[model samples]
Target: MDDFDDDSFNDVLGSMEMPTSPKKPKVQPSTIQPVPAATSTANSSNNTSASITVAKPASNPHSVLVHSKQRGNPILKSIQNVPLEFRDDIVPDYVVGRTSCILFLSLKYHNLNPDYICQRLKALGKMYELRVLLVQVDTPEPHNALKSLTRISLLADLTMMLAWNAEEAGKIIETYKQFEKRPPDLIMERVESNPHQKLVAALTNIKPVNKTDAVTLLQTFGNLGNVITASEERLSQVMGLGPRKAKRLFKTLQEPFLNK
Candidate 1:
């Protein structure tokens, strides 16, 4: 019975089957393709078109650059390379259409060279839409600075007068090129004379009194009429003017009033 039982146990172990392990699924290679050269070029071209910007061309050949920032209303789009001769109130109709204007007077009253003036003008032109008009004045001849200034001021934005006589102007023109830098000694700029400037200029003509004294006198007295009516004692008390200058100034103002 022991032999039969041991044989039966061996048979039962042999008849039982072992469990099988599961197999993993295999990964496939990627099917996505590389981009074509033409597709890439097309995409780049689309991007370029989207980012690009266009600018408008100027109305005239003489017009200032399109990118320039305009300030005051300029009389002309751009300054002519050649200067215009100064006539009696000869403002052009074209000047009225511009954004801003500048009058360059190469006159007897101021001594700036044409090149220096042009350089400065161009700088203003580049920075703003400025048109420059240049004129040469004969100093020896009876040229009225005030009249010229008034006429030009009426037509343009600003006026610059070079305080040089015709002879000096000619000398500078002969020696210096229009594109060259200006010499420090040769540079003299005079703005359009207003009432105050005229007053100062007139007072500077007096003996022992200068520009500083004239300004001081004006500051002290307020106006020309006051300066003329001021007592010599009061005028003498000013910083620049002493007793002699005050007396002279008092006398000068009195003469004009007395004459009138």
Candidate 2:
């Protein structure tokens, strides 16, 4: 029922492979940037001053903040265009946006110590709204590691990103930073108008078909799936469809979803 061909793909390799993730920096939370100034106003009636304080969010909109521990990481050198600043106070590897952060691990290292990611995830503990457990697959077979990471992602509410190599991994990080402020419509599925109209429009787009014929097929078959599964002979039975047109529609529907 699915189209996955796992045998066709292999894990990626690189000269920058590290056997273990960098150790967590020994820094205090107080190292974060100073708090934003508060507004103080005097209430003349009460003869008392009141102050309103709003906590400043830790994320930077312009540049991605990286942990100092990742100074030697090859991924950092691949990230282009976006500015990167190093810090030691943050827990995650790369702070890409306001609520997003990445924790990187390589399969080479995960294989050495299977439970390492689990301990890291436990310490991470739902800190960022968007926590990415980015894994670089450096081994020949990565399915077992991917499976474990996938399960961990589900349990820890962390998003999992699998990178074939360090260059691709760096590009992924760069993309997250560059598009962090862009609207989601760039990648979202574009919906045009209502469902019924959209379906009719789609069918009419095929060669030798029209709006009236499209609507007729829908009415006759009850739904899109049923219409697609209907036989060419049954389609010819419809009021407007001829043998040639019905055959075309049936053949088109049966075509492979992909060109290859």
Candidate 3:
């Protein structure tokens, strides 16, 4: 009986399913929350609007930038409004006094050499006040009348005549009479009293040759003494002399030697 019982138990155990451990509860992982598309777009729009507002100009009109380089100097700014004649009248008094010398050269009919006039005036002490006035003589005749007019004009501190017109003689006389109150020293007075002395006096009024030109001319002739002795022909070849000037120079050179 015991053996049968044992066998029956074994058969019963074999027939039954083996006991298994209980299954664990199913578990879920924690989920991350996703942002809303509308909220994200709204934040982006707000940032863009804020940037645009900041870029706008400030309220103050005076805040505008001014370029200093574009501005003009206040002192010189109004100069353009002044007239030329008025401005010229404002020349310094000292300059007028220094340049007060005048030269009146009459070129009515005959052609006068400006170079010769300059040289002659330089010989005179009044060269600084030398001025040239040119007059045209349309008619001939009435020679003595014109001569008288010329004589009167020559009475000025320093005056010279190259050509005279008969018709213009009256005009010259009228002009002289107008300035008669303060008549210039008569150059002719010296001319008549002592012709040779007058020639030297004329030289006193001459504008001196520039130092460089004088030195150069002197050097070319070997010395001032040599230059004085040199013939016009020789002088003509020395840089600044021309044919007309050569003749004048010839006259000048011969004058002193002849007088001596």
List model 2 lDDT by residue over 1-260, tens digit each.
01222332112111112222322322224434211110011011221122211122344557887766677778877898788887655656677876677888877776665555554544444355677888888888788768766766665667889888888888999988888888988999877799998999899988798999999989988899999888889988999889988999999999999987
What is the Cα-based lDDT of residue 58 in candidate 1? 28
Q: Which lDDT tens digits does candidate 3 get at residues 69-178?
A: 21221212222322111111111100111112122223321122212222222222222232222233333543543453343335333343332443343233233323
Off by over 4 Å in 3: 1-213, 257-260
Local distance difference test, candidate 2? 0.66
Ranked by TM-score, top first: 2, 1, 3
The Cα RMSD of model 3 versus the native structure comes to 51.3
What is the lDDT of every predicted structure here?
Answer: 0.40, 0.66, 0.32
Superposition error at 189 for model 2 (Å): 2.3
Residue 223 in candidate 1, Cα distance off native in Å: 1.5
The TM-scores of all predictions, comma-separated, are 0.29, 0.58, 0.21
**CA error at residue 121 for candidate 1, angstroms:** 40
Best by TM-score: 2
In the predicted model 2, the residue pairs found to clash are none
Indicate whether candidate 2 or candidate 3 has the larger TM-score: 2
Q: How accurate is candidate 3 locally (lDDT)?
A: 0.32
- 1 or 2, greater by TM-score: 2
Sort all candidates by lDDT, best to worst: 2, 1, 3
